[model samples]
Target: MKAIQYRKFGGPEVLEYVGLPDPEPRAGEVLIETTAIGVNFPDVRERMGVYNRAETQVGGVTLPQVGGLQVVGRVLNAGTEAHDHLVGRKVMALMSKGAYAQRAVARADMLVELEDDTDDVVMASVPCQGVTAFLALQVCTVLRPGESVLVHGAAGGVGNLAVQIAKVLGAATVIGTASSDTRRAFVLSRGADHAIAYDSPHWPESVLSITNGKGVDVILETVGGDVFDENFACLGMLGRCVVIGSTRGPGKPLAPRQLMAKAQTLTGVYLPSFFQRPDLIQRGLRFLKDGIGQGLIRPRVAATLPLSRAADAHAMLERREAQGVIVLDPRY
Candidate 1:
């Protein structure tokens, strides 16, 4: 099997296209012949040795690692005790690692069957970003119809999905922030009521104007750093802000007095913890599937690359040159 592996963490230059032995399914796992793999921001972080998570000894301090989190593939083998019914099904799975390969072993419990109508590109985009957006909208905040919402980084993978989810969840108005006019147009096309350039000097005021000075009821914040301060300033009284990612790196000052005065709520959400509540994950999956089936939410895939060019894919994402989801075709 061909795979992209990084022996040491640094930059995209560290990624190497090489051959690897085929992986086998364990007792509670299934072996998937990968069709597409989703490239994400975390993959870059992990490759740069900046991913802040507990480390496990694999090969050594500089262990060779496969990069990827979500994969759309066909099930070649299923575990005896877990997912025998999944044999020969087209599905998507969330892997801990090693998805940037021709084959991957994933826990059967984590796999979701793709509808026959679902395209391979859509299947590839759904697992990580789809689940994150669904869970964030359905569980992280108390969403109400007729309430205004704002989405930061609204042109990116999870951001684009979040925009559509907010609309489907009955938000009265949806505002999204992007950095360029092209991205702003793309965000509005995806159902955002308003798209503002976060890079603009008047962005905070623009959000305020859209709400008629009332501020937004819910905020889905993807970019951290200075954007956090702006989000806080744009929040409505008693507003809820959910922080899903810190793509801009974390360093921010908060106004505690302002928060107290407005009776605001600030919450940080990590999707992995949502899995601890299986019902939430199940509900999210159902919502995503239903939305896709009904055309209430659309999966936007900006580009597809051959698996061997996984390094270039990462570079594209890190450079913010790609929009929506970028997928890798392992069969290529």
Candidate 2:
């Protein structure tokens, strides 16, 4: 089997494509012949040793590690007969790591069976980012119907989906924030009712204006630092803000008392934690699958690269060159 590995922490250059023994499925697991592998920002952060502080192995610092969280593939073999019915079935599997390979082993229950005609690349874009977006709005903070939402990094993989998911969840108005006009336009195209430039100091004023000065009912804060701080300005009474990521870096410490005035709520969402709760995982997957089937949610695949060009994939993500998800074709 061929896989991408990084023996040291650094840049995209650290990713190496090399041959390795084919992985075998263990109990409660299945072997998948990968068609498309999803490349996420966490994979880049994992490669840089940013997650090294964690005690658990979330794409570990262990040398020669394979870094990835999701893939779309076909089941080649099941470890046990209890799951034999899945053989030869197409699936989108989410795992903690080892997805950047030709053949990967994933927990049997973690795989979502897909329709035969489902596009592998498009499906590959869903498992990680899609689930995160769904969980952020649906579970992390229950978004009430007819409420308004503000999504930061609206052109990003998770951000793009958050915009659509917010609408699907019955948001009366979905406002998206992006760095450039082009990205803001893209966000508007994804069903956001409004798009504003996050880089602008007056962005909160734009949000307030769009909401008719009432402010938004929900906020998805992915870009931390100043953006996170500015979110409070437009957060409405009893608003719920979910922290999904801090791509720009962590923000200044907050005073818990700030929430006292508006009765606002703050929550954090980490996708990996949901893996332990199969019930929640199934709920999220069902929502995404149904939404896509009904033409309510669309998966955006920005580009696809071959396994050999994994480094280029990482570089594209690091530079934010892709507007949507980037997938790796291991068969290449």
| Per-model TM-score versus the true fold | 0.91, 0.95
lDDT for each residue of candidate 1 in 1-332, tens digit (9 for 90 to 100) = 99999998888999999999988788878999988898888788778876544552122224688878888888898767468788889887886788999999887767778875678777677777888887777777768888998999898888899899888989999999988899899999999999998878678889899999999999988878878777877899999999988668665666677679889998867866765565666567667777887999998887999998888999998888887778999977
Give the backbone clash total of model 2: 0
Candidate 2, superposed: residue stretches over 4 Å from native:
54-59
Candidate 2, residues 1-332: lDDT per residue as tens digits?
99999999999999999999988998899999999999998898889998886753453467779989999899999999998899999988888889999999999887788898988888888888988988899889998889999999999899999999988989899999988889989999999999989889799999999989999999999999998999999999999999998878887999999999999999989998898986677678778877887899998988999988999999998888988989999987
C-alpha lDDT values of all predictions = 0.83, 0.90
State candidate 1's TM-score.
0.91
Residue pairs in collision within model 1: none
